[model samples]
Target: MTDTTARTIPIEAFGPGAQSVDVPVLDSHLHHVEAGEGDPIVFLHGSPTSSYLYRHLFGLLAGRGRLIAPDLIGFGDSGRPEIAYDLADHERYLDAWFEALDLRDVTLVLQDYGAAFGVSWASRHADRVKAVLLAEPVIRDIESSALPEAFVGAQRVIRTPGDGEKFVVEDNLFLTAVLPGAFLTPLAEADLAVYQAPFPTPESRTHLIRFPRNLPIDGDPASSVEYLARNEAWLASSTDVPKTLLTYEPGFLVTPTIVEWIRENVANLEVHAGGAGVHFVQEEQPQGIADAVVALLARAEAR
Candidate 1:
């Protein structure tokens, strides 16, 4: 059974915010920023970023639907428990959040790790999902050969045992460097700080450090690869659900070859070129992402 009570929790306002709501998902309180009315447009962000990632879209798409962006359990303004923060851990909290809120006919807007986790959840409940919009989604296992050499080297360093902890946790490289470097237009210091504020200590960043490790590398993390496989099959077969993939120039996850593969493979999935960026398209391309969501809703309505 799912708890449908909407509990408002206190969240520190960062930049211009929406209505910040706190709902208990599992033992920890999960925080989300929300606004608007009518059907729900739920924004799920990737690593190191929170609902703050969708601040720009909150205003842009307020008229379009009910906008909700929740910080995944261990990240953002949400509670950080002393847990492993693995793929299953993330899904548990997210599932609870959805049930607590009783979100239905949802338009799931996803990016990065958000795509990996959210898409899998949406696929499982295709009847509940009204539509899906993806930006630089990690929908399948990636090839090392497809990535930039510099990025590959950094990934290796992050994957190494002690080096991974030192680089991501001790130095907070994801917030300080990797995140800033992903944007085509550099994020301002204040904006950067908003992303960095949640994980002030190494202990706070257990989830961040574990995110890259959760990636399906030679199927070592069997659970994550299984989820990816499920979603990929869902994308290929689910025609009733409206799916949109927003591609960008110099993209990281959705390379040119992957774009072609998606076009040929994923059923009822529309691909839109969203201009230039590598990974964090939200920083540079919020309006485009919002527009795509609005369009998806309209298309779904028409059907």
Candidate 2:
């Protein structure tokens, strides 16, 4: 039987009756929020955000399946182990978490670096994934010049040695600047505080410092570039799997150029507009995102 018991996290932003869980994975544990019961519909969040990113989606997607949103290791309520916290580290932890839960026939809702993690995993385990829904995901290698000037500048600074530490660790730029800027409107102080709670000290912000540097910009990070290429090959060839891309007006990552590339290349893909937003489409279009996921699920069921 499915465990419908509610586990509490002291954050009002998660709203009332949020169900939390801490599952053992590797040397650490992954914290997640779950609702309903059936085949797993897993929600994976990206850098600087946690399971709280999908708090609204649980209710919106209620009764669709077992809704689960987990905070990637080193983020949210999850244990911060002594490790490099690189893409490989995150992937390893996530692989263990999925095995621990014994999730099967999963429908994935992914965004940001979560895209990299989920898509790569799905590529390796195609039979296990039922469907995929993505919004502003990191799916390919990007030229540093293709990014916005301000973003490129920020990445350069964050990739620097001492400067990177000061920018993310001391200043907490990811939570204070990058995250808030992703939303179309300003995030409320209360909601922002929920994201801030996990990383209270400079040491706690190690993952934040590492994430930007790990991006596959200009193919400098060969590992990430190779990883993305592998997933891209799977996306192009997996014609049987249903895929949905939720796009927002003037998106941050999935810009028009990239979207066009995706539509042309990825097989069995459907594109839906998620209204006006930047990187964080869920905050601006929770209902739209929910609708898209439902539509994808129906398509997968039909197949």
Which numbered prediction scores highest in TM-score against the true structure?
2
For model 1, what is the error of residue 85's alpha carbon versus the real structure, in angstroms, after optimal superposition? Answer: 0.7
Q: List the residue pairs that clash in candidate 2.
A: none
Candidate 2 lDDT, 133-215, residue by residue in tens? 99889887777666778888888889889898888989988779888887778887777888888888887887788778888
Which digits, one per residue and each the tens of the lDDT, describe model 1 over residues 101-169? Answer: 888999889988888778878877778888888898877777777887877788889989999989899
Q: Can you give the lDDT of residue 285 in candidate 2?
A: 83
Clashes of each: 1, 0
Error of 2 at 47 (Å): 1.0
Q: Which stretches of candidate 2 lie above 4 Å from their native place?
A: 1-17
The TM-scores, one per candidate, come to 0.92, 0.94
